[model samples]
Target: MEARDKQVLRSLRLELGAEVLVEGLVLQYLYQEGILTENHVQEINAQTTGLRKTMLLLDILPSRGPKAFDTFLDSLQEFPWVREKLKKARKEAMTDLPAVASVRLPRELSLPAQL
Candidate 1:
């Protein structure tokens, strides 16, 4: 994941942990997309509370490679509000950067909507 993306996740950690529902479909989706390995899913699922699960997910996602951010974003279909928050954060983070620095960053990827 990009530094900016990581930063966004960090910034929203509290909100996400409070709001994200990771017990069922979210975890399944991420695992299916290859963003979360079986071990990762097990580790996250092992957490006792929703907050812990989400925090673990946030911690794991940054290390999951470049596609992790978008794949995770896609997995947020069950929580469109969270997805919008992330997209807005990403856009805001990009615009806050200096022109040259922003230019060096990867462009925002357009992801297909979850049906």
Candidate 2:
């Protein structure tokens, strides 16, 4: 396994799920490679931290030394288990409200009627 792959695999082993950082980057790269669907990216965007950090991770990866992440990603194309997990995670995320969604507007506060 590539080194980055090991880190990613280890994280999954520990949590039984994807690392937010790693998953985001993999999704971005796959999108760039034209292997991922736009709907999937949109769904991921609604659920994940915005793409900036994920982009940064991909941009900086060459400097982080070797990793197994590439191999794992390459294997995703044929890995039904990984794909099932990804779909399930996405399903769960779609139902999860954004952090800000819980902060409700004041019920009694009114906005000025006139502009």
Candidate 3:
């Protein structure tokens, strides 16, 4: 994850918790690799912190029933973060990714979010 993404996750961790951090990081990595689009990030991030929003961000059990949700989940699982887990994965070219989403980040890195 990028420093900025880590910063965002760390800030969220304080308001949320470690589980949220993990889910946020997973979504962050997805965003970085273009699995999740800018619109998707913005929509999800705008939601108040909660399991429903988290599930939407994680592409699980979305309000739209199984068909819509499954398609999104399938695409997400094909993201480099998932597909490259066991391989020497290079960062996907930025040209291939949607423009970076403007997620809120804390001004300072919380200790746990530091590298």
Candidate 4:
């Protein structure tokens, strides 16, 4: 078998384990609890499958190694509000950008004429 396939099979062993499934399911339950705001919900919905996959990955990270443990430790230090935002981000990174403003872009994002 190809090296990548071997890695994938090895990873499947961990992610599908009972403890990983329980933790991932717990996170999903928390997400479905109606605590997240509308924008949060929309963003999550935008990448629903990817988010589910990441949450699964999170559960398997410990099996992956020390860098994974470091990431876990860092997560513990996140600011409360930042951590709240990241709970969603932990599952969906791209969909977690700051919300957009009115129809026009924010001035920080606006561009002057090419001239």
Winner of 2 and 4 under TM-score: 2
Cα deviation of 24 in candidate 4 (Å)?
Answer: 18
Query: What tens-digit string does per-residue lDDT give for candidate 3 at 1-115?
Result: 3333333333343332313422435556556655566777777777777554664554422333334322333344434444332121213332344687887657574355546
Deviating ranges (above 4 Å) for candidate 2 = 1-18, 22-24, 48-115
Tell me the tens digit of each residue's lDDT in model 4 across 22-71.
22233344334433334543454454465464454443444443343234
Q: Give the TM-scores of the predictions, in the order they appear.
A: 0.84, 0.28, 0.32, 0.22
Candidate 4: what lDDT?
0.40
114: Cα error in model 4, Å: 80
Using lDDT as the yardstick, the better of models 1 and 3 is 1
Which residue pairs show collisions in model 3?
none
Please list the C-alpha lDDT of all candidates, in the order they appear. Answer: 0.89, 0.47, 0.44, 0.40
Ranking according to TM-score, highest score first: 1, 3, 2, 4
Residue 70 lDDT in candidate 3:
27
Among all windows of ten consecutive residues in candidate 4, which has the lowest summed lDDT?
18-27
Clashing pairs in 1: none
lDDT string for model 2 (1-115, tens) is: 3343433344344333333344435666665655445664565555545344344433333333343245334535545566456445545554663565565568577565676
- Kindly state the number of residue pairs that clash in model 3: 0
Backbone clash total, candidate 2:
10
Could you tell me the lDDT of residue 25 within candidate 3?
Answer: 59
